[model samples]
Target: MFGRFAQFETREEYLEFLNAGVEFVGARDGEPIGRYNVAPGTRVLLLNQRDDKLHLDPVHWGYQPAWAKESGRPPLINARVETAATGRMFKPLWNTGRALVMADGWYEWKKSPDDAKIKQPYFIYHESKEPIFFAAISRFHPDALDAQEDDGFVIVTAASDKGLVDIHDRRPLVMTREASLEWLSPETTPERAEELAHDCAIPADEFAFHPIGKAVGNIHNNGESIIKRIYNPLV
Candidate 1:
């Protein structure tokens, strides 16, 4: 359900937030800021097992198994939870490639009869002011694509929780510090995966949502105001 996100403005800002030590319940590696608009080709942070360590790397947002590129299907943005375990697009990784995607907040649109031509943007995140670590799942790139050009990733989405249901039909599988650590472990088993998926919802009282200006629709619009709370009746 997330289309737009807020990325850290500076590397230092990112380091500070990450160093706050709230997200390590899963993996320990840190990541840089990300693109405002996360699309298929966008590079995103991924946590994977490597030599007994959880390594975080930037990966392409689109997913294409090494042997399935010619399947004639466009890349998918979100992987459905109901079928991720058995779907042709997500099963391979479902067995053992879960990951974490770091984000400050995500954008959602609201449609109204009064403004058919525009959709209001809402920024959603933790009410605690902590950065959000969206739960993710990844697979090894079958091809040896350039590190900067060909890494791949996909976010897992679940049925909306009570507070978020009105905003979107599906919401990302947001990880808790504990669940992230469990999902990132190379030793994580299928049974463990099911447990993690079942517990991904954040309580309604733990989150905050606010309408922001239309400038956020433009990928070029990057500022704290994008997530600043605004009350506009038109929204």
Candidate 2:
């Protein structure tokens, strides 16, 4: 359910991960932390494929269709994998568009019945410490945007795997670094893209999750503590 995530602060840090080929998006300097509000308009880096080159773009955090007068939608942060192929909002882009939303880790909330205000935060990431590549589909709104504006993108998601099911029912579709390059390859055909999206999954054995402090709820709070393990992981 990638509701909130940590992101790189500078273009240098962002490109370093790119040069190293880390492909997930929405990374932060901190971990195991909480943010109160991480609404749209937040500036985040996006790695998009264009003319065979990986273009690093910083776009607003939410997906906004210029035509829509009101953005009543919940954060346009994730596109359900099951419906991405045929849904009007995601189909056109997935048919010919794709990208790698890079991230070191992501956050999800655990529902609590006793206290509605008490939501637990967990940081999910690879056991090996590699950046996660969130399989994404993006289309340029060349005709949809006003003049002088550039392109934007959205991330694709699916039901959570075994490792994350306990924390949330859904998770961002993730790809390994090797698969990320292929997904971002301009030469990849539409058929190839569909196969990649359909077949891709990060095994439960490869990832680790841990509960963290509730400080992460504040979008303004950014630091290394967010990723710190609040309780020793059972794994």
Candidate 3:
């Protein structure tokens, strides 16, 4: 599961990367962003499609459906792609609420076979050094008092590819621009959406990973240093 990630680009860089005339909402000037850790519940940059157009907006990372609040269940941060299309919590949003969670890289912890207590962290990024767009779904809580803050999203995860299976059992559903557009397309049907979710897994060879300091395990630690590579024999 991808619970933490980094997006270390300026607003101009993001615009160039998206290559679309998009609007940015909820961004604060001089705020230390891009080079920090992003966690669940944190407001994050999201690329959503509406009426065949992509719009950039800030949304909460955790997903909370209207029924979940009444059920008193915690927010869902990750949805398994294997069952998302048929799952009770995710099925409703699978087709209509798709989005792209923008990120530079994501963190995964590798458990030590010799020592269960030792869990080493690693930062995984695209080999091309381009941004990774995680396939996700967004929903607006019906009972929300504030629309902006209440809109939430959850990353979709698929079985890890060969290279990353040792580090984790699952990885976020990373997508290319074409795959993302198909995913977020309003014209896409539920069957096609599910098919895309199951088939659009990024190849493991396209990614590179390196061990990082344990500082990333703590939510209090937030900075570029958190993702700094460190030598680890266990890795």
- What is candidate 3's lDDT per residue for 1-235, written digit by digit as tens? 6798887766555545666443444343443355557888777877777774566667888977667788898888999988998888888778678888778899898888888777888999999888778998887643356764337889999888788887898899986666776887788898998878777767888999899888888887887898788875364
The better-scoring model by lDDT among 1 and 3 is: 3
lDDT by candidate, in order shown: 0.66, 0.65, 0.78
* Cα RMSD for predicted model 3: 3.1
lDDT string for model 2 (1-235, tens) is: 4667654344445355546443434343433323323434564456776664556555555564555426454436678877877876777777776777667778888777677666788888779766667776665543334522324567787777676788888887776556667778878776777677777677766878888887787777777876677864222
Mark the regions of model 2 whose C-alpha exceeds 4 Å error after superposition: 8-40, 66-75, 113-117, 140-151, 232-235
> Which residues of candidate 1, in runs, are more than 4 Å off?
9-39, 66-68, 113-117, 141-150
* lDDT for predicted candidate 1 compared with the true structure: 0.66
What is the TM-score of each predicted model, taking all chains together?
0.80, 0.77, 0.87
Question: How many residue pairs clash in model 1?
Answer: 4
User: Of 1 and 2, which scores higher on TM-score?
Assistant: 1
lDDT of 1 by residue, 41-147 (tens): 66766656543654557777777664565766666667877778787778877886777777777778877657666677777778876777666767655335555
Q: Name the better of 1 and 3 by TM-score.
A: 3
Off-target runs (Cα >4 Å) in candidate 3 are: 20-32, 141-145, 148-150, 233-235
Clashing residue pairs found in predicted model 3: none
| lDDT, ranked from best to worst | 3, 1, 2
What ordering of candidates by TM-score runs from best to worst? 3, 1, 2
23 Cα displacement, candidate 2 (Å): 16
